[model samples]
Target chain A: MESVGLVPVLCVSVVLFVTGVAGVLTRKNALIVFMSVELMLNAVNLSFVAFARQNGEADGMIYAVFVMAVAAAEAAVGLAMVILLFRNRVTVKLDDLDIMKG
Target chain B: MPTFNDLWLASPALLLFFGAMAIMLGEAIVRPASKTGFWALALGTLAGSAALTVVIFLGPSADAFGGMLRVDQFGLFAQLVCTLAALLTVLFSDDYLRALNLRVGEYYSLVLFGVCGMGLMCLANDLMMVFVALEVMSISMYVLCALKRGDPRSVEAGFKYFILGAFSSGLMLYGISFLYGATGTTSLPGIGGFFMGQHQGTQATLVAIGGALLIVGFGFKVASVPFHMWAPDVYQGAPISVTSLMSAGVKAASFAAFARFVYGVIGTHSAGFVGVLWWMAAATMVVGNLGALAQRDLKRMLAYSSIAHAGYLLMALVAASTGNASNNPALASLLFYLLAYTFMNAGAFIVLAAFTRDGQDYTDIDSLAGLGKRHPWLAAGLSLCLLSMAGIPPTMGFVGKFYLFSAAIQSGQVPLAMIGALSAAAGVYYYLRPMVWMYMKEGHTEARVAPVAFTALAICGFALLAFGLVPGPMLGLAQTSLQSLIPYTIPTH
Candidate 1:
């Protein structure tokens, strides 16, 4: 059985993280931005697992699990906020959230 | 398997967690007509937790939960500050909630849960603990900000905060993973020990990048410049009570974890991030203070003021990098200033909470017009709070600023100290503008003060004055708290 090298896994993780960041910055739809955040978290999980394997320890893997759980909790609240925003303002686009601008 | 000793060590947070759960259960089962019982329970829980934190503060330092948390005087001090902030916030929340017609038992439970997370954050000894605790605190805050669901502005604030908050947490998590790979451990002291050993090439690069990312993540949480765009809008939109707690309690807890991480993980090798922090502190102060000058809304102005205070706190971290660990005036000043900030900042918001009409907070600067003539004592309390914020003499803010700047000068951060002083001086204009309206302007505002909230404000005003006049005992305590971090604080060359 062949295993991936640490450098390659890290590179892929970085690329995925960059993409997620771009999505968060460029995407206007609140739902997409949130999904992008999840993507970033998953990218982190991949790196954590890879690092744990390279280090021959379970700490990073444990951290990955924790990140997943926390992300789910965040999603639950984030989606509720989105729904709440829609209920009040009838829009989910980030641009529409301009009620309290300076 | 955890021992009884571990439970005892962590009981302050555990108590809040259980209290929050009890509130939820009791609210559901009893469905009481009045929320006073629930409010009293929450306040009692916070007071009890604060008392326990003080007892723990008097005890010796130790680690609990297998070194997941350090039970030290430093963390205990932060926990005490957080509990106090939460207590005052709850004391004032009932009236504000009633004024706005927000009837949900969850408000008390969420506040308790949030404070529980803050206590855990102060004591967190591991990177993983910091991340988890941060989310726990932030999620509660997200809901609280939008508790006024009928208001579009409140919902927008909550959504914006959620998106940005979640984004920053992801960035922080990625940084933590890099750090874990670099040091092969999630423990703060373990990372410091790794740096103490030989490290070169790829490992060094990993640490540098990881540390930078971590700072950026913290920058957003504390609402410093470039990352602070969300602050004014969210602060303006959220319910005033939530804003007060978020500004005080969240900032204190986040700064606690940030200070511990900087002193513990990046100890002695402050060169890695000190330069970055220097610029951040400078920009945050200048931008925050200047930004406040243009604001017509009082809430927005205070939000910017809070950002400027974050800058001052970051200056202390910069100084910490230059001096010996145990004797570092920077760390001591940071602790004292956080306590002072929690009081004055929250006290200011309590006064703003008094301006409710038709289920909305009237936070325009004009809303304060003629307050001095109409409500003399309320205006006096607010004036004291504002003076303290402006660094006026015989107030806690003055004493705190003096310590912070002197510590910076002592660490040879003279230029940064000057920038802080100049910006704080500029800040005085906005702080005084409200007073001018309260006393000199002729517009009318029928503000009503709640007894409990007024008492809390009085306590804040008295503490600001008393501590400003006799700061010796408090300064001594702040300095002694640093002793517990000796093992983690490596002496600089």
Candidate 2:
């Protein structure tokens, strides 16, 4: 099998991460914000897998699996919270959920 | 080969995890209308975990689960602190939950699960383990915060916390991947070993960037300044018991893992990181205290107080990283302060939870007016907690702060200590306001107290006084726990 270069892979991962961070900071829709978080996690997984392949070690791959599992759990909880928030406030906008602001 | 000894070493976390599962299964099968049974079961699990922690503490320390976890005094002591906080939360929660009509079987199970995650965090020896354990703890907490389903505030708190928590976790995972790439290993000790050896230029840069990201991640967890925007909102919005648990258990567990990573893995190898922590500590203290002064809500005030306390604890981290690694007084003081914080901060929340009934929380500082006349015991208990939080004499907070500031000074970080002292002084006004409201202000009296919550408050107040008066034992315990980390002599001067 042919080998993929490392710098390009890392560069893509960094782009994905920055995009995710921007989405999270800029987006108002709760679902979109959560999707952004997922994107960031996926970016992390990409880097982990790339590192694992580059080093020819299983550790990074194992970590990637763990991160995926955590991301899944986070998604479950996040969706549940979104449903709850929508039920309580009839809106899923982050700005509208500011009843407890200082 | 892995042996039974490894299981024994991980027994505390294992017990809590199994206990959490058992409660979930039992709730499913039995479908009990009241959560009393689940409460008892949760308490039993925490007690069992605490017992296992003591046993592990008394026994020899060892690596378990292929070095993913370690059984050492440092981790065990943190486990003990977490278990104690969980136990108290369970003890204080039953009536509060019932009062709020939020009692559910899942609450106890989630608390148990959260403690399990905390225990694992304390013992985590690998970056993967830390990430997994942190998620386990945080996910459970996110759910618990929103467990008051109909409350808009609770739902908001949960949503906000989940978003921020997940975002930070992603950042941390990316950082961990970088560290893994640089060191070619995810193990904490391996990372340390790799860093100790001369590194290539790219590897060194990766480690530096990775370390910076790691700080950002933990910085969120500990609610340091610039990352503390979520704390007051979350604390005020969650149920009081959950808030108490978050402030005490979550903070302690995160600090435990953070300390291990900084001291055990990175040691004093990176002066740049120490400088970053120094600035973080100073800024956190100033910002947390200054932000707290504008709060009228008791919970929000306490939230800011917790942030300021995080600042003080971060100072200990700064001292540990900047000065000697092992036998560092600052490190011991960190443990001491966490223990002290667990009691007093949680106790204050218990007092607030005491007044809550029928899904309504009277958390305004003004509502506490005339409580001194109506409920003397409740008033006294809360007063002691508040005084302790204010770092008054004959309180655990005082001793903890004394040790922390002294250690900072001993390490020649006098300016940092001075900033901490000044901010802490500014903090005293808000901490004392509740007491003034209870005693002096003339307002209506409609306060009620729950038996279990009162008992929890009494325990916290007693610990505050006892530890403050005779800090020798807890101090010794904190000092002894530091032996498992890097070794260094306390400076004679």
Candidate 3:
């Protein structure tokens, strides 16, 4: 409470997280869903930065970098899989593919 | 002997890595469709890894990379079991894959990667190492489960596994954060020591919540009760070969970490933690056996059976409760049971693998009909396996169950022990139903396509029988493994 300027940073990060979660929940497009995941990562990054500033520790910054690395790796694999999925099924509409029901 | 610590800890990984490379390279040297050579080399690697693990058992437990990784008797024994599991699985896969016309060179490679992951998990002492190793194991397994991509069910299994696995990982990471926040460190004993100091503080609330969430993550991995919804679908869809590996190799490695986490890290601080775990263990036992009872599909039945066994293991874990400095019979029972459990479960899956033939997998209880008449040996092997799983006398499973219950009783956890015993007794009905189908059915069914590979794994099942009857060496091994918790008490053991 005493280190007063952190409120705006926390609020923005929380908003970013909510928006990302909403986009992932509502979006039907695969690309947009992926974008939402990315958005969530960015929100995490923002929070990490804010925490880094507040805690005056370098760990949060290092964690943000690691998260970015993981995101990149995930993107590479996810995009490859998406391409494979599209090739297997003619269309990419998320709802159109119902071939394998649990 | 290289002081027992030189490079033996990582030799298993190295052997598999080199073996994979050698196999892939050997593909060009061999005639097309010559599957025997690839598997031989793969087995050679696993055997070498197993031997290395034995050598590592001698002495000089080393903490590689400043204790992030510990190579001790506990990890060594776990890796040995994992390697042996992979080896047995490959034996079964040889015939099964051929039957499905799905024999590919990548099978050995994927199996290697899975073993690699399991070994890393066994070795990991740090939280980050555990996560990384888990991902490595899981990613390899995801691909392996859907190796038969032509089958829609296989692909679905892969997707479901990946999604749920990632979800669990995220939950685990979140839990780890709270643990870190509460303890101010990620080292297992550091957290343990931290909890020791702050057993009754403001952090108590966070610690309980975090510990419970962590349990949820682990519960999923072990396929215990509530998080068990995935096992049946995934097990049924996966090629029988992969399922064998998943049931054996994956289970052993997961339990290794489970013991370390519960016994070493969190158990030291609070009674409430162990109390929560006790209920989780109880729920897992009851739900698992009941779920298995309704399954007609052999794979699905075994899947649920696996959950029940996981519950049994949880009993060992419950008995093993480490926070107090009491002599825990539970941990000892867990050790014996895991050894027994591995042999019986892996053997049963082998019989299932044996029955997979001519581009079709036989999984229905009816498929096993007249098996005794059709193929006496295969029927006998499978019957032994099932009987063992049902906790019948003179089998490894019985000893395991007996040890577990006796431990619970000795510990004064009698009601818990009784529940496990009753649930196990109920388990005998479904387990015996398979036997009746294999024996009493009148119709003629085709004999399983007898394969030498499957024969070897069936031999593993018989080995369990021998161990069960005598149990001297195996019990000695288990006790030795249990005794060598040197890494836990001394970081530089």
lDDT of 3 by residue, B288-364 (tens): 88888988988889888888899889877777773234556667667677767677777788777766767888788
Give the runs in model 2 whose Cα sits over 4 Å from its true position: B487-493
Residue B328 error, candidate 2, Å: 1.3
> Relative to the unseen true structure, what is the C-alpha lDDT of residue B446 in candidate 2, on a scale of 0 to 100?
77
Residue-level lDDT of model 1, residues B350-435, one tens digit each, is 89999985687899999999999999888998899999999999999999999999999998999999999999999999999999
Q: List the residue pairs that clash in candidate 1.
A: none
Least lDDT summed over 10 consecutive residues: which range in candidate 2 chain A? Answer: A59-68
* Candidate 1 TM-score, true structure as reference: 0.98
Stretches of candidate 1 above 4 Å error?
A: B487-493
Candidate 2 overall lDDT versus native: 0.89
Off by over 4 Å in 3: A1-102, B1-6, B21-33, B199-206, B322-326, B486-493
Error of 1 at B115 (Å): 0.5
* Leading candidate by lDDT: 1
Candidate order (lDDT) = 1, 2, 3
Cα lDDT tens digits for candidate 2, B76-122: 89888988988888898988898898868989889999999999998
